[model samples]
Target chain A: MTDTRMATDAAATWHARLDSPDMDWEDFGRWLDADPSHRAAYDAIAVLDAEIGERAAAIAALLPANDDEVAVPASDAGVPDAGSASRGTRWRWAAIGTSGALAAGLALLLVAPSNDGAAQVYATGRSETRSVTLDDGSRMQIDRGSRVSVTGGGTPVIEIAQGAASFAVRHDPSRVLMVRAGGYEVRDVGTRFDVVSARGRVAITVAQGMVSVVPSGGAIGDATMLNAGQSLTITPDKQIAIRGRIDPARVADWTDGRLDYDGAPLTLVAADISRYADSPLVVDPSAADLRFSGVLTIGDGSRLVDQLRAVLPIRARRVAGVVHLDAAGPR
Target chain B: MLAANRHQLVRFFTGRTGSVAEAEDVVQEIWLHVGQPPKADGVTGEPGAGPIANPLAYLHRVGMNIVLDRVRANGRRQRRDAGYVDATTSTVGAEAIDDAPSAFDAVADKERMARLTTALTGPPEGAMRVFRRHRIDGASHAEIAAEFGISRSAVEKHIAVALRHLRKALDD
Candidate 1:
């Protein structure tokens, strides 16, 4: 076979294998890194596969169906009749249109912020993350279990009631957007920043522009100007610390359903996950201080414990509706 | 053991099938095959039978077989559907047309469906069968190989050919 043909076939095989229940991810990673063409080919097939699957029913209906074929039970075949099929087609197209509108809304949220008193309150459930368009046209992606109320008139103000929220604030010299996250306030001159308030701690990370972090009732002298790629952590004990050179890419990783950490305390990991899970995840005193580094992909939340167990000398179990993580004993 | 791997298997198949909902059905089918002993007397004498040395590998093998079988079934369906279309179009003047797709259907949906139909119709019969069994009916490659009296590698080649054809047709 020609090299290209070989690569394509290999990519297809790998794609199927990766989906296999017993796939070894490490092996797959090795194969992916072996050849650049392999990754490209695999990506091509994956994208096409998704597109076709998304329209699988419509495509199946478009095929000429025999009287006998109709009896063949493909329950997912949504196009059983002309009338209902038309409805399905309309719904699909409507969804496509909504996504287009979302794109436009996203553009406006980034480029424009109008100061008008359009009060909007956005909140997310334990398992929900919501993106809101403020009256000023700025956008905020509220994390799971987070609540934020926005007032868009003259110097728009956002009150982060609880949990984490990321802002893509539009630059306006005439007005400054102020975010009241717990006792700390983040005043955006024209910037993108994330405020995470959890576990008696508040963290502010900037992705772009500059923001000043000030105490709720303190003088401007105490205010600290944080530029792009900076992070500030405030504890309940009133200790404020700043960490520079924050990887901007990691600022809002949670929005993508991933928790990216590098040498972070397992206690904090458990705390972050507790926001989404039904039961609180408790780290035993010994395991609490142990640090872990990895990307935990959020699914059903059980994977977090599984991954933690895999790399650490730890054990996780559900006891009385609470998840507990403790140091493991050797067999 | 199967229950523990259920989510992982679903995630795996989701990548291939592109829909988690569809992938759930595929994973469930794998579980059924695993739970069945493949014997009336419950004897464990068959080759590689009894205790399933590695459940993950077993699940993987069975899942692949299911995909291959699905490919074969889809190929048969395509041929049958094609014949039905041909007969109807040929008898247009002689026979009263029935169940003809309405022209009022959404044009974009129709166009996409047309591309898929065209893609499914053109591959070689054997390759198409293998492809359909796996891709459409969720048959595993192993089962397809066994049913067709061919090596597993041959089945893979057939599927690869079908995939290439579908990819090319859809890309166009």
Candidate 2:
């Protein structure tokens, strides 16, 4: 076989194992490294595979059903005429048992760490939520498009770098959990609260117990103590801090696919919607300060803007990939 | 885990892009996607969220997807540039000004779909059926093998044959 043909065959074999649990990525990496031609061949095959996947529904509509299967005789058994020529090479792509491979791979990665405490970063993709439990039995339900990192040693510190996260900390008198976001810090001891830090703003809503929110570089005495049903937001400019009341049950409602807001700024709502949006949802300056109060169900995250438009006098326009929301003209 | 395997991931990307700087950029992009937190916390309870079965494989898949998106974007840009030049050179002022990039993309997409349809018929006799079943219909190799009364390997071979044929046709 020619070198190109050989590489194509190898690429095909690799493509078949793309989703297999036992996929040996190390070997695949080596194959790509071995020859530049191999990478080119594999790229062609991978891109073709993705294209086919994208147009699968359209292609399915174009093709006819495989009714010929019923016409073949039982005595001919499983041999296809087109496959007969390559019968000798059939063993090359034989199916292997896949059970337990996924479990084994997960096991290798989830090994419990030592008390030395190395930081681990956890993040969620668009419209994807993740729940992580800390060593001290604290649970965190991370919202989509959010990033949180935790370091467990003597004192546990949780940082919400972007997006929103809800924390339910287990009571530990010896350890005070420190949660930080947008240059502000929250100290918690056996409490549940939600923190949203995005677009240069940090908002924390207390659902249960009490937590102290401290400004960046502020002493503990300067911390604002928030009780249950209380919410505080530090604006993007850090010039104004807003404290409001919220129903404790409404905290982190996105976990149930519903965003419950009680008079939230349009800018803050836009920032929350941007997590599920394929593109950034920017509010026009005219609509930025509008207060919105409603429950928006985030089903697949497609109709969020439409839902917002129905409730408020806002018009959303797509220019390129960004969604710009402006106040609608009088209708 | 991403931090621990950074070097290997960079090497893997470098092999594909054939440039260390490009590979480093890709790895950095991945890091930004994954989000890096400054501090750490202790963890001990069961994973309350859906667990990714294999994160390394997941990361590799994500890397390949990023590469594919970049390649597709480059292709679209090149096509759009060529189309823009054609419109400006062949048409008068008003007509040329009316031809937007979005319209050009629509026309290019239609042409590409036509080419794909033409290439669909280039595969071997039985290969098309297997490919359609596995790729379009979302059937597993084992399921296709059972339906055809053939071994799973036969199903894979048929798919490979179809892909090879389609690649050749489309490349031309």
Candidate 3:
């Protein structure tokens, strides 16, 4: 095969493999880095897959109709969040245990986690919010567009694969509740802490008691102690920044529809807004660094944009699907 | 003019809001607003009260303004259901809601949907079944292969063929 043909075929195979839970990321990374063409081909395939997934229902409707409702496989081992998988598909998975290998793969992919013990996955959809009490007596408030897998039989562990979650743990020294996000892990030494993993940044805020932030991959030395009224933000590039003396009560104020930004970058604010609303809010590179301080009540997503326009010397316009914020022209 | 281009307007709103339901609501609100008198206490049936020199442009401008107002006025306050709580238990969930794509994204998505519909017809029936079961039905490859009485590798190959064909069609 020609090099281009080979790359395309390899990309297709990679796409199929990655969709399975058994994919070895280390091997995939090596293959991705091996050739530049591979990366391009992979990107193309990924985009296509995402597009197809988004419109799967609509396209499927147009195809030759098959009324056979796939039955859900008998076991609940692979069920992540029942709400996440449409009821029809869940039943199909539950009923389709004809092949043990496929049933195992379905469980792994749907409940995608690396837990030593049995894990239960919790997920919130675009605008959905769910609060669940763990078997260990800990309460977790899940953020929108977020998923966290909880493994509780021995030591309680939370693996936040995406979005943010606020944890209010009942102080138990005998069984530590651990939160793993990105490359860092927050071990609760009996405390209430908010762990936000969004936009390539993980910020851990200690509302009460104390917690230790340790690098999961050992990229850094020692567990950093974060006490009450303190916050630690780790950027994707592994740069650690610490903030002291933040109001402990204000930690997770978003639960009350209030976003308190004390001199926060506009880009960060935009990222937060993008989480709640669909419109892509773009701050011009020139205005991206502008800092804002105050309380913005997020009602409808657009009002926040209006509030920003009122407070700062910026022009906000909704063009097509994008909300563009630019430095206002000199009067 | 707005009535003439109702479908187009709905598409425009859908692109703006990233939701067909919201788009329909916006269009309905716009229709109501257009029928209402511009000023309260004015005659609802008065001649030329609702007429515009450039009806198309006027319809679009009014439609967009209403959407903006609706967005500004809308506030989503999530009531806390009795599930879990601590000292800091609040009524609202600390999360973003209804993350919609911008107009550009909606347009692109529409284009992709059209392309996907066309490309989906290219693969053979067995390959299409594999792709559909895995993608739409959310079945595992092993399950799909078993259902079709095919080997695991063959199932993967069928899916790869379907994906490659679709990806190629998209690139072109």
Candidate 4:
């Protein structure tokens, strides 16, 4: 259908659907099965819905101003606070499992470290990511599926539990920037780069300056001196090692509302999107050999699968909130 | 909506536009865009569609887009205008404006916003239920209450009460 015609039809259907008192599984199923173009239409409208949600009030002056243009989007995850860690998940978009447990809204502060401070929690939610400005005028991208409650916002002692995250440790002579993911603690003198934690391992890449990551005190995770264009892999038992440079932009794509990679392993890409996505993106174990390098929008992860299908015989289906991606029948 | 009836609508486009006439023109543009549908998705309105359950809301949104588009379309002119804004203001009342396209780019960071919305949404459980019932589920107050096992009045109270909290949290 023409874009205009499609938009009209989709909007009408959506309006009717959204207005209905009861929108059940059968209804949604019927709508989906009714046409191949159904989801395409829905996604188009979803963009508009996103537009409405963001600029509702600003547009309200044309409406009643006091009208319901103030309607908000859904919380990004199962729990409102959970989605707070990342972008929120609406009911319609809740077709994913294991959304990132995000906290709500931004908290900008010039955090100064207290000498006796304990770990304070800073978190982002599913489909949500955050960058906090430190007192040293430095910043860090808090990745999805993780929470690091540092003692002081200045010291920036965050623990990475699962998923990939990055930090641009502010350069400060007095402060040692440290991040703990599993057993490995990334200690830095001053540096900028990316960090990903998964399968009981954390990979740290230094993009600028240098860092010395030993364990918390004299305890060491195989201490390494990482400068620009270098990386380190820290295992669960605090085993640390070194490597070469990675594409910081591609790894840090989530910070910019994008999921991008260069010849990225499908399994690894799935793990990446799986962090910010409300839905879990599972790749076929058989197709683990496949490599994907492209951009996927932060919201509506099915769009990523759609992009993936353009090149490979992969299909994604949602069942009980799980989005399973497997090789399509035949090739 | 008629021009005479659009006291609120005009104000909506005012911030987007520099003048009352431009705002009115945007209102006219809204009429064309709204009565039919959007180019992208057409006319996906909600049940109550709330305050925006009319043509005017669509108009305002269109107006805003128009203004942004105008800004983009006039980038070169605006840069020149910025240089002469002081002179123009002293002469013909130009707006004291800093042309910033990057501010829009700043909106792209999901992390900072993610941290923000968590607080605005008030820990999810509190407001999400109401938001879903009211917007996504299209459920009535009675239906929502039945689902939640609260009275209809309780559901209404929930929405009413939730709005107060959201307003406070969002600080709007």
| lDDT (Cα atoms) of all candidates against the true structure | 0.58, 0.66, 0.60, 0.47
Q: What is the per-candidate TM-score for chain B?
A: 0.42, 0.68, 0.39, 0.35
Among all windows of ten consecutive residues in candidate 1 chain B, which has the lowest summed lDDT? Answer: B41-50
TM-score of 3: 0.40
- Candidate 3 has an lDDT of 0.60
Q: What docking grade does candidate 1 earn?
A: incorrect
Report fnat for all candidates as fractions from 0 to 1. Answer: 0.09, 0.20, 0.19, 0.00
Error of 4 at A72 (Å): 60
lDDT of 3 by residue, B96-129 (tens): 2223335654676578677777677654545556
Model 4 alpha-carbon drift over 4 Å, by segment: A1-115, A144-146, A152-154, A162-164, A198-201, A212-221, A232-244, A278-282, A300-302, A317-324, A329-331, B1-172
Q: Kindly list the per-residue Cα lDDT of model 4 for residues A88-136, writing each as its tens digit.
A: 2122223112111100000011112321223335666655677776544
Deviation from native of the Cα of residue A91 in model 1, angstroms: 62
Off by over 4 Å in 3: A1-116, A219-221, A238-245, A279-282, A299-303, A317-324, B1-172
What DockQ, on C-alphas, does every prediction get? 0.05, 0.15, 0.08, 0.02
What tens digits encode model 1's per-residue C-alpha lDDT throughout B1-172?
Answer: 5677778777665554455786787776564433322233232211212233344544544554444334433443575467632322222222332233335434644676677767765546566556555555445656666666665545555655566667767766
The Cα error of candidate 4 at residue A268, in Å, is 1.4
lDDT per residue as tens, model 2, A27-121? 77777888899878887886787677566666666655543544223332232322112223212212234333432232212111222224667
What DockQ score does model 4 reach against the true complex?
0.02
lDDT for B11 (candidate 4): 57
Question: Compared with the true structure, what per-residue lDDT tens digits does model 3 show for residues A1-331?
Answer: 5777667767777566543333333344456556667656765665466446545567788766753454322221121221111112211122223324333422222111111234567888765667878655578888877888776432467888877788887643333468988778887744788888766678888888767677875522255666678888787576765555568888876667678888878887776766566677788877876998888876544477877788988998789988888889863
